[model samples]
Target: MEESTNIDQCTMEQKEPRKVTKRKFRYIGDFQVSDLECPKKRRLYWNPTQKFMSSSRRKYVTLKTKIHRLKNRINYLSTLLTELTECDRKFPVPRSIDFNKQFVTVELIQGQFVPDLMNLIIRFADSSK
Candidate 1:
C-alpha cells in the first residue's frame, strides 16, 4: 500500500551518518583576487591571476542566495579562491600555475558554495589533502 511505502521511505531517511567532522577554510597562500565583476544577474567574474581571469575553465561553480546586504559578496568568493590556490613561499611567485595540482582544484566539484565561499574550499581540501 502507498501508506506502507511512505512509512518505509521515512524510516530510511531517518538513518544517520556514524560520524561528522568540522571543516575549516584554507586560505590561498599568496594568491590574490585582482578583480571581481558581476556585470549581470547570475553571472560572476573572478580573477586570481595577474593577467586577468578569463572564462577558460570547462566547468564553473555557480551559487545563488538571498542578498540581505548591499555588500559585494563575490569579493569574498574571489578571496577564498585565491587563498585556496596560492603558494606560501615569500620570495618570488611561480610564473605558471598547474590547475590540476593536488590541493589546487582537487575536489572542487564535491564542495558546496552556500551562504559563503568557505565551504567550497573546505571540501576541496578535505578530499584532496
Candidate 2:
C-alpha cells in the first residue's frame, strides 16, 4: 500500500507542471529610446522628458533676457531722475515782478505817471466811446 501511494504521488507531481513564477525584471541604468526598439513604446518613454527639458531651457533664457532689459530700464530712469534734480536745483522759478518805465520828449515829457485806477478808467472810457 505504501509503495502504491508513493507511485501515485510521483505521477501527480509530474502531471501538474511546476508553476514557476517569474520575477519581473527591473532596469538598473537609464535606457535610451532606440534601446527600447518598438517605436510607440520608445516615444511614450522618451518624448515627454525631452520636451520638458527643451521648454524649461527656453523659459530660462526668456527670463534672463527680461531681467537684463529691466536692469537697463532702471539705469535709464535713474539717469533721468538725476538730470531732473540738477535742473530743479540750478534754476528755480521767479514768482513776482516790479517795474517802472520813463520816457522823454525833445521839449516836454512824452508820458506821464498815472495812478493805476485812473489808467484803467481812462482805458475803459476810451473803449466805451
Clash totals, every prediction: 3, 0
- TM-score of structure candidate 2: 0.35
Off by over 4 Å in 1: 22-129
Best by lDDT: 2
| TM-score against truth, every candidate | 0.16, 0.35
The deviation in Å at residue 89 for candidate 2 is 5.2
For residues 32-117, write the lDDT of model 1, one tens digit per residue: 24422334311222223312323323123222223423246677866766776675753453456676563444454555323246
Which residue pairs clash in candidate 2?
Answer: none
Name the weakest run of 10 consecutive residues (lDDT summed) in model 2.
Answer: 99-108
Q: After superposition, how far is residue 87 of candidate 2 from its true place, in Å?
A: 3.6
Cα lDDT over the full model 1: 0.49
What are the per-residue Cα lDDT tens digits for candidate 2 across 61-119? 99999999999999998887667668946645443554332232322343343455478
lDDT score, residue 43, model 2? 53
Model 1, residue 4: what's the lDDT? 100
Screening candidate 1 with a backbone cut-off below 3 angstroms (N, C-alpha, C), the clashing residue pairs are 27-83, 28-83, 28-84
